[model samples]
Target chain A: MPQSMQPGDAKAAEIKAVSIGKTFGAFHALKNLSLDIGRGEFLTLLGPSGSGKTTFLMILAGFTAPTTGRLMMDGKDITDVPAEDRSYGMVFQGYALFPHLTVEQNIAFPLKVRGHSSADVKRKVAEIVERVGLTGHEKKLPAKLSGGQQQRVALARALVFEPSVLLLDEPFSALDKNLREMMQQEVKRLHQETGTTFVFVTHDQSEALALSSRVAIFNHGELLQVGKPQDVYERPSNRFVAEFLGEINLLPLDTVELNGETAAGKFEDRTIVLNKSITLAGKKAVAAVRPEHMFISASPQTSDCNAITCRVEGATYFGASTKYHLRTRSGTSLAVSMPTASTSPIAPQSDVWVSWPVHQGFLLPDGG
Target chain B: MIGKSITSRKILLLAPLLLFLGLAYVVPFLGVVRWSFTMPEVGLGQYRALMTDPLVQSVFIRTLRICLIVTAAVLVTAYAIAYVWVRGSSVQRMLAEFCILVPFWISVLTRAFGWLAMLSNRGLINTWLQSAGIISEPLALARNELGVIIGMTHFLIPFAVFPIASAMRSIDERVLLAARGMGASRTRIFWTVFVPLTYGGLIGAGLIVFVFALGFFVTPAILGGGRSVMVAELVYLRIFQSPDWGLGAAISVVLVLFIGALLALMRRFIKPAHLIG
Candidate 1:
């Protein structure tokens, strides 16, 4: 799964962005955006649709300019640099391969455009073809190649020059699930071999977790949270972050109070205490518990920090894990995922108890 | 739009233009064709004599040369305009397109009259050139093929600009950006990406402009003033001045065949539907 992947530690080209903002007349496409992408790090800006992810990447690519602030690379200000002069490799969404050129010609394009001699172009393109695992398909036109192969050609063309950074904007969003997964690994391996900083944009959380050294979750034109995938998944800063990373169970303050949970206990059903001291005041204080954290049993247990007795609304048998839907007395529902159910497996419509540790949950600010 | 059945909906949704063309244009064209063949009670005589005439052949050759030059000039200028507009800021692009449209709205008659005012012996340009001591005797600017070509090219710029520009615009700008990000320079990007991507539009526009130029009459008549006679003016002379309707209609039919064959050959190369988006 390439989970052990680590970017080369040595200092490489550093891209430092500072408070970049862009507005398209009436719409604020990007606002107050700033992120310092470490040299050789593969960072992904993860988000749902319309989260300003692509706008941030385009600012880095130099195609769209920030209305305010500046961008620097290795301490050299490059805010106003043209895209062509930025010397970056990019895999555009949908892989905008030149249809008129054959595979060899497409790969040779960058070299020829840089004014390399014809022989040099031929040799360099041939070497890149093999690098991208497209050695035998040089003569084929882009249309003749499958979507995956065309994608590889795009990556190869972008990589042939070995630009300072590689920018990808949903490069595999067009491929099927299997091909997409395969290309994800291929891209990770290529990053390892070349040791280039890759800033990828995508909405797929699993893909982000699979590839990035760190993932930055974005929402409503702001960076919601950024950390190692595991860290971010296990610990999100707010409700949006918690919900965006994965499926989350939101416990209202009352639910915590009824269970006598000290962490995030209720105060007027709006505020809660995560500890003995703090009285968090808000219209709605909510705690997010991951679906995997909750366990289902045949009966309620008093010792459990957080437990609720609800009817087993439904059950799903996945080969390895069994998921159960439990509805509380207040009609609130929760999903509990576990490797195996009890010896007396809870059936649908049967009363059951759900339990999880208090420390596993977090209080998120109300979305409003 | 060019085929029989005039309304061949199976061919294209816009096929009704062929019907409109047949009614308004083909009827008059056939009438001319019949008139050119059966004048003076009929024979192969008027066309045969007309073909042998040295003046008629020279004028035909001269018109072909004029059309080629004007087409070339318009294509180059239109490409430059479209390229600049495509890459410029939105405001500049809108302004450039608006500027191109301005010359189109001004009538050809008014523009030719404006050219007459500008290129006459005592006209504004010649007056300035004379005052600047750059030329003498008005430089024979008017009453020649030079005046005719200038006016014709001026009127034909929009036809040359539209199809090519639309084609160029449809070419995903991302392809050029991808090439550049891969280390392509401006000139390389132009020749390899932009040129090839928009080739169909350019050729289509060029063919249209060249074909339209072959049959132009008003600008050439007003500008050339009998010193430079294009084939259209020669046909007019044969029809009305000499009462040689047979020669005139034959010339008209020949011109139609020339332009029609060009349109057909162009359709073969420039089918926008088969072109990859």
Candidate 2:
């Protein structure tokens, strides 16, 4: 929770990207994206492929120059500085470990390049190797190590220099699921230990949510939203952000009206209430709720909850939870997930009451 | 049994190539080896004479020296060209490839003659210098060891460029970027990371150019103008000019053994996989 310090606190803004845009010929890779990375914060740029997240990371690393923007660091513009002069550490996708160098040499490269004494290089390399749990594998080449081991070497190499900022470009994308999770925990621990500003890019939403203090959602070269993981996931600003984060049930609403700190709208025969207070620019809106927030039962659980009657069309059993796919009378499809141990075996075709807290549902402009 | 049969079938597919090499290369080489030993009334006299002859010793020494110089020069020049080929902009890469391949497609004799036309005394270079009043006399730019070295280096640059460029192309570009991001300067990245990664290519190209330079016949013969005689030219002289078949065969055997020893020495430094790559 190092990001608890708000980005608006000017002193905490370690790196600020202002009005960044990149275009190649006729194709725009990134629009005028503006963001602030707080000091010692773990911020993940989450998006689908071709969302220009990687392009932004490259700009921050100084590997790619912005077409029109000013990159500020410590209140100074660094837009024209080259990558080598920026002194930021980067872990590229696929690790990019030096194939010809041994693990120790690979980790020692940055130190040696900075003209550290041989003794200092050796001591630092040994220390980081042990920190990454690669003590015994120091003498091996990258090709001789496993995928996870190579990833550790890449991490150790990037962190050994004690850079002020660390940028990772999908470092764990090549690992198996188990190893990727393990590496994720390792990176989280490293981030806490180093207290360095970390900007990570990944297409995997779960990884973005689990590791980052704040996740910035991107799509089609635009910065859609940036916020704390829970805030963004629970209350996405648009349809793309809601859908990209995870499975969400969207029900069309009509005659939407804004109340003091809530919005009341109608969905067919049910009156839907959203907890967020916002100005409505259009009459049409959609009620958005995560599948996990909704529950299926034979009867409505409480009066405070928004409830709808739907026919269960199908159910999918995941080891930990059962997902019931339901369709309302108006032909709006919805999904409700319940813990397997707590749910009764509701057969398909059974009519049920799907209920959720009114505060859990949010409203988005329809088709946005 | 099935595995054995499959292996045998694969070997059978190599029958024609094996037959051709055995007849065209191994068989003639065996004859030369036999003549080196048995010629001149079944004794090692020719080899003993080779050891004592000053002309043969100087020729061998000079040939080794020239080949070493050419190999070094070709490697340094080819590495620059190969780097441009792999990492340059599209226009630069196309220009580099044109420079390498255009000369490569032209015959060696044509290239040697071209060098002669430019470098020989009273030729283009000398005539231009004289006309420009830069020199009172034409310089001895050709018809010596320097001429031989220049011609051989030019003839062999394209050979060295291919392997070096291929090796450079195989390097993961991210490794360089990673180094740069870690604050390594461009020069440090090139010397420490880029060059070391292409070591396999450098070694492979060096071996090819050095081996080819050792037995170079046309460039040295035409450009040397009978002065700088390499092992191959000496072998031709002894066999065809002096008609001393036994001495020539002895020299040829020694050359082959020298190349074999070089290969063995090089194998200690490079892995077979690196050579193939």
Candidate 3:
């Protein structure tokens, strides 16, 4: 990838990872992954367990060093800098507030490490106490605080130092659903109020969508994609991104040939043609269409370039929407999601026509 | 009915320990207490003699002082080893455990005798020093407070290690990591997080090791020789050599009362379960 020419492209304060890789014995925990985050952008690293998100975050925070390559904060190499000297704020998975220290002391710890005077630490700690909505908790020890209050204190401790970037490792995985959503908004509000670069890690895609400006999807120690939340979710680059981000109907093609302006593929018992470029010379491919994009009707026409004859396998009704599982004669299962209305096209055992625009389906390279 | 059954079950499990303590501990201990008051064909006769006998009273006082020193030394040394295991890498932790358990497998008499050979004036250590051309003459190694302290510390390191190490292990790793991430140095983390959390173990180990060191027979007897006369050896001499069972029982009674006082003080200051765990 070519580097962007703009030097201070608002991402100037962001952490830059260069050829970073970490391995434990023979197992490669992280590959040669590089990313340049935009400054003050809420970027969430989304992946399942062991996808190297936490490893990358730890390397960025200077707690753990990368096996190979380097890191730069604010345009200077800080790969070998110790965790204390790097001055990066971090909220760990378990909130990790000191049980021995009161809320005020916990919040003032990073400042104290920075050699702040008692008067200044007290003033800043009080300010942060208000900032995290933990006003009366200053005198209470961490053990006395509720889970949500402990989380707030941890956040206050990180933000009090006002570091260049804040790294949060699954900060909300411990909270219940309602509190998780509330804290998500609270974090976003804090970010907006401070304009501090926030790098977060989570396995939940909904969380990434709800809070992040850009979500980096990772799998098996490799970065699958990184883009705006809607861009990555709606227009995925491959099948894995599509499957991981949300539900999608994956239809395999036996063969795909790109001929001038036209693209065509042969399914099990029939042939399909597309008027758009397929980008494949001669290789096996598949088209991934999101479940909600499939338009189903009672009858189908041969004149329609984007249509398939499918029999309904099952239908499931969510509160506001219904999902229909359609199987073609060749036994290829395709999902069609339609908004519930007065006239519903899908009930159990109904014959349906699955149709969508050619642009709605993407021809993913095989095994993507 | 259910409450009675639960009480019976508890009693069944506790019965063997109660029976063992009854014969081995309480019976002999009560006999000594009874004998302390019945010496010289008069009640409290030998018990009053201890207060009048300067030499014997000094022996008890000296025993307490040396035992306190040994206990303090063992707690500090064992804490160093425990702190290392709590924070150090796997290999360092395992090697420390191996060193501690090695002495535990060997007999206490062998350990005491081993110290005797090491601390002896013309022992292996002085021989090595003379051959190395470091010292012209043999240094004092045996029959002194130095020799007794050295032997007792070696014997008690394992007892100290078990509780302190167990307490250090129970401490959550996240607590230390949180401290480090918050920019506490290695030294600061140990002092602030590890030490306070392991306070219970240190106190418990100190109490147990101190009480055991007070009545210590083999190490001090062999190494102290004539100079360091602990209460246990004095009692042994009175009962076995001089046939003074009354004086022996009186000394035994004093030792038991002193140990009980030490335990009561420890309990008042710190909780035992917290430390031992």
Candidate 4:
């Protein structure tokens, strides 16, 4: 965590895209999108399927040509440059290791293609193999290895050449849960140690938040927003980003009044204030709060908290936390998660008070 | 318990095939083997004579040489066509697939005759060249080793493409993309990644075509013009023209043994399980 606070290394490479667009027979895979990838920054493209995040990553890697716009690396136009000329390392979703090649040979392929000497290739391959914790698997074919091992081989191969940028397309999606977490840590450590620019694509929001310095949310072939993980999570620009990042409770409010940057609204005969008023003057509005931010109590606790009376319909236990499915008195379904360690269990079908600080909620125009 | 019943059911289903193979193929082939060694007071006499006979030796060598040429030609042509079939657009793939399979739907004899029509002296190619003033006279395109190769390769392309394209299909498209991303040029990716991954298909197709070509009778008979007699035609001539059944049986036995030896050698050199397993 401390390492993430440090600025990117000065030697890191930067990539810039200017108004990139791609169309395949009138199907717009990527719209007119522009973004700047900082040197040595971990940027994640987060979206559901068909959201064009993978297409954008492909365009960045030069595997796909943008229908309109130019890509620049260090201010040099590389829009038409082929993938091989870009010299970026990529780990595909399936970890596409050459089936015939042994792990060592697979890791050495890029170096050998780059005309590295045999000794240099060997040294680099050995170091990367060890770095990726695949020391004894050097001579084993990819099919002979486990899925996790094959993924490690892919990571090692991609990182062996010290490429200017490393692009990963859901590298851990195929891995089991434990292996996925382990690989995530491994990738983060490698990114930290090498300080190479990394552009990762995944639909898993937790993965996007955990591994990236900046998360770019995509939906319907358009970029919704790009910012730091906390910024994006706490202050999503629209309803899509808010609900997509995690479990959110959207409570409809009426007669909203804006006061500077804050807004007060009436919901279920109770006055509630939202800290961030991003809604218009006279439009339907909803106050969105993440499940973890809301609290469920037997009775209202504080005057400062925006509280609502709800009936606890059910509870799902998650070891460290419990999520209570609740329905407000006015019949809006909502959920609130409370840490099991600090909160007592609430019986199902019981009336409860759900409350959170006004500062924890954001206002968005309804039906966003 | 369920697994045992399923396996028993599978064996029960296999009973008919096992019975048919035992009666129809194994029995007759065993009879041929017995006749080769036992007929006309034979005790390795035919084998010894076959080794020493210059005519038989030439036929054997010629069969092997022609099979090698056919296998190589079929492999190269099939690899190109299979590559297109796997990686090209749907239209291009359909066209390539259609061309490769044209020799299959039509009978082999018909295709050979078609080739003979186009390749004979003063045939379509020669006439075109002459009319276009590219040459002074007709070229000998048929009834030679070149003609045999052309005809055989054409017939074997579809067989070769099946295995190669199946192998190519199993290769992840992203692997090639990853190679390109890692600075491998298109040509480099083909040789290093694409070709090596498809080695299983190549070897399987190669063994199939080579073994098939070694025993070919019709293509070589029509296109060989008697000057390039292969082993199968030699066996035919010994039995039908000269009325030497024992010699023909001996040659057939040798051909089977040569094929077995070649398969054994190929197994030793390349383990077939590496591709499939």
Candidate 5:
């Protein structure tokens, strides 16, 4: 094993799940979910807690057996294989470094277990330790290192053996925002450099979007959608995916109709058009618009845009953006986020117009 | 000084226990040391006899050997029980605790007698073996080194298990899972990760069991069948039966010094924090 195994050197594994289901006694954790992870792909499983993303990740790692399913690796049945036999590197949520071992020993554990010679283990340990920026701290125990340093040790230990797949369960959840972003970039760089198949699980949507080549959104034991981050974020299949990814404004509409590839719906007293068409048999539907897409102004600004008049009830000032919370005359609530640099701050309780271009809003089945 | 002022107040609170220890343990121990040295000629007569006495040397060696055996056996058995206590389900944990507590709460003499009954020739074990046609005659199971070891190990097991179990409970469950994910086999994970993590508990338990075993008197006397003459039995013989108080005091002094040396050696390897935390 080398210190930093190249992506081309790794045997990146392609994994497929066939209708996997898991049950803990009477409670079902995951239901009939099938997903195929391509070789050398950074696929992230994104979901809220208890949405079975971690369970699915555990099943993929072969730590948890599915009650009913078949897992295949490169078309070979591996459902019965144990985690040790699978040789998948996992950076657990807490890092899980051996408290008794120094950083170098912890990184060299896998190599030593595989019966490598002392010289080979030493060389690989030195290389990976330096690669992880842990050169002078190789002799320091896990308890002596800071959280980010310990995290790097875990990452180095996992990558040193050049496993077929790398599984991470919210590895950055414990880190602060700045360190998390830095680690995420480090993870992405490592993935690109090694070209190893990476399966990451996280509830943080931004993290999922920033790191993954493909993101799998899960909810209520079901795989809601799996696609590129842009595809999933821009065109969420349902209201859950739409709202879960980020803050979205959903407005109930009536008499929904699909004309060619555009959706038209009646909202309040005006007819609105959606850029993307959705097939909903019922007349009741909802128009889902992202908070950033909606622009708030002291008065109506555009003639052909979809607009609603409302009172600004609240304004939250982020560093780069300000979000205005508004309530319509009919008591419907809406939110609009605008760049702080471009827009003057709107006072709370001010009457404003929340509008978006016709193509920015999409329609979804109502009450789902 | 602030430190002196605080210590003065603290001394008032600690006065009762300090008085009790000084009167109850320290004074008596000092008396024994004085008697051992100043009994006959106020010289090294008892010490010289101890060096030249073959009987005393044999008993001291036998005591050391038996204590070592009991410590090893108790450590192994306790570790197995503690592992189960940590990883097993509720019922298994309850059962393991029950087994350890039963021997722990019972009187030491009663437990030794119980072992004596079970291990005595023609007792439960030998009778069963004979009935099963495994042996033509009853085996010498009791009143020997093996019998003494078994009885003492049973007595020391609960003491050994608690510290190890505490250490085991402190280990993060995810560490083992991480090891398995990193391609370590089950046995490898146990030895490499799990065992090393429990070293503090092992050292604490080992110190407790070995020190207590060194001074053991009851179980060995009952189960040893007069064949295993340990230091405690020799002390008893010298003090009570033979009426040689000076010699007994000298042997007691040696035992105390040996235990102190063992503790000092172990203290270098085991941090006091590990024992408490």
Candidate 6:
């Protein structure tokens, strides 16, 4: 794995995007986005469609130029560099393998184009093929290979030249659920093995969370948040980030009061205590808690937990866990996911206590 | 049973086309075939004469040479046009489509005459060149093999453009981008990734243009001005002027068989789907 990198390439390159923005006529595809991608980091740009995540990745790959901003690699500015000179590897969506070339030829393309010796090209292609687990399938064209095999070929082709940075644009969006998971694991292992700076773009929250060293969330061309998966998931800064990451119950709060390291807010008649400090603005706020963090109980389980009384509306059994749909007394709908094994089969229309630790709930600005 | 019924229904749906081809094409082709061997003496005498005829041999060789030249020129030019048509901006694409399709919709005779007017010694191009002092006299741009090639290449470009453009359009743009992202220069990417991907289109276009050029009659006849006669024109002269229907039918039969063999050979290299595209 270490020999794959050429000498003086042990430390991967870092990227800094400063005040990057892209506009297409009247539309804004990205707006004043600033980010620092550390060396050898696996950063995933997570966003909905048309949310500028792909736009940023393209900017990083030098395929699309930013309308305004400086893109720096290590320390030098590369905003004007063309994609060919960037020395980046990109796994495009649908794999985009060369249909006419066999897997070996496809992987050998970049090396040949770079004027590598024929012997070097053959040796590198063989190495990358073995690394990507495509040993016996070298002679097969992309059409003859299965979808997963085609994906492996694409990956091998992109990484054969040992590019300084690797960018993947939703490379697994076309695969089935099981194959996507398998490829995700494959990509994670490759990222670990190669130690190249990887900038992956995807809308799958779990994919972003499970694979990335850091996740950058985008919405409406705005960089909403960037943090570790746990940091963003457990402490989302806004309602959109909280909801986009996963299903979360946002209970509208009123009369919010801020204190050091904690905030007290009112949820109808119940006073909710959040263990994190939050600044108050003119707009409303919501107490956002993931459904998995809250448990359904017959009565309050602990004095240190915030409890809410709600009537069970429905229950969805999901094999290992059950999701209980509940409505508060003031008619705020909430969902609580509990382990099916420990759940006592609460009936609909029955009042139950939903309790979570004080630190599990966080405050977010409720734009709605 | 259901599959058999579906096959029968499909054949029924194709009945009109089958009837049209049998009457319009197969019947006439069979007449030509019958005349090739059993005309003017009910023997293989015409074919024997054809085998040794120097005029026939020269005409066939010249026709092959012209078809090869025209196919090569048409594929190279149409590949460029098709590339623009597939990957260019909307305005450029519209212009390319207009250039290919407008001449396509015009009559082949009109296009041939158009080329004649442009390429003739005393025509627009020569006159312009002479008036501009680029030449003291008109160059022999028409009334020769060069004139015939120019006319045939222009006429066949539209045919080449469709298959090439369809193949180009179906290529994944991201493949080229991926090549670029992997440190391949634009020219390198074009040669390595873009050109290889369009091999199907190029082969399909080459075959269509070559086969079409083989059977061409009007462009060569008009542009050749009797000096550069092709096999098709020879067949025309044999039947219409000399009234040698046996020889004419034999030539026609050979031309058809050659084209069929060429298509069969090409089919070994390219799939029907690629050709259609």
When only the first chain is scored, the TM-scores of the models are 0.88, 0.96, 0.90, 0.95, 0.95, 0.97
DockQ, candidate 4, comes to 0.82
All DockQ scores? 0.57, 0.86, 0.42, 0.82, 0.80, 0.79
Question: Which candidate would rank higher by lDDT, 2 or 6?
Answer: 2
Ranking by TM-score: 2, 6, 5, 4, 3, 1
lDDT of 2 by residue, B1-277 (tens): 1245567669888889989989999999999988888877589999999999999999999999999999999999999998898899999999999989899689989999999998899789999999999999999989999999999999999888988888898889899899899888888889999999889889988998998899899999999999999999999999899868899999999999989888887778776455444
Worst 10 residues of 1 chain A by lDDT: A269-278
Pick by lDDT: 1 or 3, better one: 3
Flag regions of model 4 displaced more than 4 Å.
A1-10, B1-25, B118-141, B261-277
Give the worst 10-residue stretch by lDDT in candidate 1 chain B: B268-277
Docking class of 5: medium
TM-score, candidate 4, is 0.91
The residue-by-residue lDDT of candidate 6 on A1-368, one tens digit each, is 42565434545789999999999999999999999999989999999999999999999989899999999999999999999899888899988887878999989988988889999999999888888889899999899998899999989888888877889999999899999999999999888878888999999999999999999999999999999999999988888888999999998888788777888889978899995645766557889999999998888767779999999999999999999999999999999999999878999999999999998998887773
Best by lDDT: 2
Fnat of each candidate: 0.80, 0.96, 0.41, 0.96, 0.87, 0.96
Scored by TM against the true chain B, the candidates give 0.89, 0.93, 0.91, 0.90, 0.92, 0.95
Candidate 6 runs further than 4 Å off:
A1-9, A281-283, B1-20, B118-121, B125-138, B268-277
Candidate with better lDDT, 3 vs 4: 4
Report the error of model 6 at residue B58, Å: 1.5
Better-scoring candidate (DockQ), 3 or 4: 4
Cα shift from native, residue A251, model 4 (Å): 1.5
- Which candidate gets the maximum TM-score versus the true structure? 2
Docking quality of model 2: it rates as high
Docking class of 4: high
Clashing pairs in 1: A264-A273, B36-B246
After the best TM-score superposition of candidate 4, give how far the Cα of residue B62 lies from its true spot, in angstroms: 2.0
